[model samples]
Target: MDFDHIAEKKQEQKATVWLNLWSNRSPELLSMQLAKKHRPGETVSACLWKSGAFNICYRVRYKDGPDVILRFAALGRAILRREKVQNEVPEVFGSGICWAGPYIVMSFLEGMPLSQLLKDPSREGRPVLNPQISNRSLKRAYREMAMLILELSKHEFNSIGALEENKRGIFIARRPLTFNMNELMVSANLPEKQRDSVSSEEDCRKKFTARCLFLNITKELCAEHSQGPFRLYCDDFRPSNVLIDLSTSRVSGVIDWEFTYAAPAEFTYVAPWWLLLQSPEDWESDLNQFLIRYFPRLRTFLEVLCNYENKLIEQQLLSESQRLSPRMEHSMETGLFWVCLAARYSSMFDEIYWTFIDSQYYGTFTSLDDRIQLLDQEQQHEMNELVKLKTDQSTEGKESFTDHYPIDKLLEL
Candidate 1:
């Protein structure tokens, strides 16, 4: 599809909105003037907040009226369709959280983003770091997010058949796809001659082979258990997606479910760490604290949760086993195969990095020797240093508090 055309259309729409909004007066002074119009009894003043990247948000309030937020969807029909699909997904509305379609209109959540909170060094502005965040305030936030995901998982769609029948296909599709690095070698605006130094097709093929090998290895490791299927929200699920009340560093609501799906249970379990951009250092710094705070008595709770998740997967798999096809089998082996296929074809490297890595790790690496050798001495040295750092960290003494969740539990099985 003509993504450039789509992007250009979106830009035109954005420009039109900007023109209309600023046609008569200075936009800068508008919000302040509007807020001044608020009367003593007014709950809020109607004003636009231009913080979101994709949507325009307006905060509206009136005397004795609850403050409300209205978001205007900015993208074209495709985005609207995706939003509609997301809205149809039961868990979002089932959580007793009301959102008005894809263009969200809801009561204004009264808190700052976690990003803002972290910027504040003071305890009042930061999240309360404790053994257990019993502050009734924090509980609501965390519980609400967790509950939303739980409810989403409870509502299943048969588009891909039951879990057992489509386990391999689901697993394969779930594996992240990577973008073609070769396209990035040439700037879109650059002259053809200027990009002559770009590698040959053979060279590109080698790199692809190496990546496939990595994916193969990862797949082998992930599929060893053959448990069952569950659901996943493959996109961001970080603290930034949550709103925590300022008075209590607790989560008030969960936002963003654009990438939700039903997949392997393992995918969901590792989501928290994955979203945090898991690294050895991150694990060391927050694993214990997270477990202690979020899953107190981690062993029992983790076991129960894992068991429940696994059971669901098994149930889904069994239900769909009879209709499994060879192509589907290959897809299942790869996890979210169709999605991965689309990502691979998109040619957008940034979008497909994870998926590419997954597939590359699983495919082949024999052709990568040349590319591997081509790496500059400094890059090789850096890789060595990273390996050493990881090895040393793992060998070091264990912390008094450690995550009860197993490493395998974090994989997208």
Candidate 2:
């Protein structure tokens, strides 16, 4: 079986394990957990709200008050709480570990996901823009989104890492947690740092090497400000996480800050890759076709973003020195947007690099071997072992799949 197929199956199995475990115990245990915050016999009902790759959300309703969202983290014990961006972000009510897992209780923003307004999920493959949505509505949506990004970029940290809270206070201590890092860890089945496993560490190193090398090159070539004053960036900040008021075409709230962290300022300079509701590397259509559909929307978004940038500057809410529009514009023009995208998404890195980034930066390569010399000897050996390990894992996964669901059982189904 293909490595991607096996990796995907492994992910599905993990999610199933989590869901089954949660379902079996959550009704009783979850009620007990929520009981701490609310009054007894308040008549609360909870139902699954949204399930992503690494977390699950439930909408908890009460007979007397407004609804709140309960999110269970499948990977880490972290939560996002920023008073500065409180208007746009969720306000955490409480968080703790229970029998099920680590969960966060927060205010539920009212409105549908922006993705619902922009595209039809009923479509089979890559989602296209909704024909019913007017250009004016899209522009209005972009304007609101522009303001949110600008506001988020206002907060800065000295170190590039995730914001975590301890007894002392909040600090940037942990390695920056991105969605790709979590996904890679899952796919590789890497264990906790306490576990003594050389292969696991090798797999982790393989993932980081690409990012480290890319950043070093980018710092020298494009992002001179990559070293300091890192800004908050949400890996999951897309239409799916953005809530919108349909009637007014306004952004109601931004949810899913779990994958956010203090990242290099260059990351915040790229125009959002979600403008088309489909990622460039994952687009099913030809590259030209995707770009044709993409550029127009990109232009619309940038125009609205520029207008917001000017408004914020004029109001003294933003300064000319802190203006993000020009940097973002330059990123797109210089192909730095694609570079940043490739560097960030591990699964999409190969496709994005070969298609748009590699040749432009490093010239054409006949094969990966041709470029392997760019890395140190130690890294080159590690990469070879990682590939062998991946191949073995794929084989083992295929055998395990067959053992669990044999050919006869599959035929019977």
For candidate 1, lDDT tens digit of each residue in 1-413? 11232233433554464446443554334432333333233444557763443444567665676555544443321232223233322121111111112344445567666544333244452233332333443333444444445544444333321122243443222222111111121122111112121134443334344344434444564473235544444344555556777776566765544334454434443323322222222233333354343333232233434444455558773223222223233443444442343233333322233333433433442444544564557655665554444344334442321322122221110
- Per-model TM-score versus the true fold: 0.43, 0.77
Clashes of each: 47, 0
- Candidate 2 residue lDDT tens string, 63-146: 776677776664221122121122123577776556555566777788888777778556765456775678998887777778
RMSD of each: 16.2, 7.4
TM-score between candidate 2 and the true structure:
0.77
Q: C-alpha displacement of 207 in model 1, angstroms?
A: 5.0
- Highest lDDT: give the candidate number: 2
Point to the candidate with the largest TM-score.
2
Candidate 2 segments whose C-alpha is farther than 4 A from its true place: 1-4, 26-29, 32-35, 38-41, 74-89, 121-127, 165-170, 191-216, 246-248, 285-288, 364-413
Model 2 root mean square deviation, Cα atoms:
7.4
Task: After superposing candidate 1 on the true structure, give the runs of residues whose Cα lies further than 4 Å from its correct spot.
Answer: 1-45, 76-102, 120-199, 210-228, 232-234, 271-413
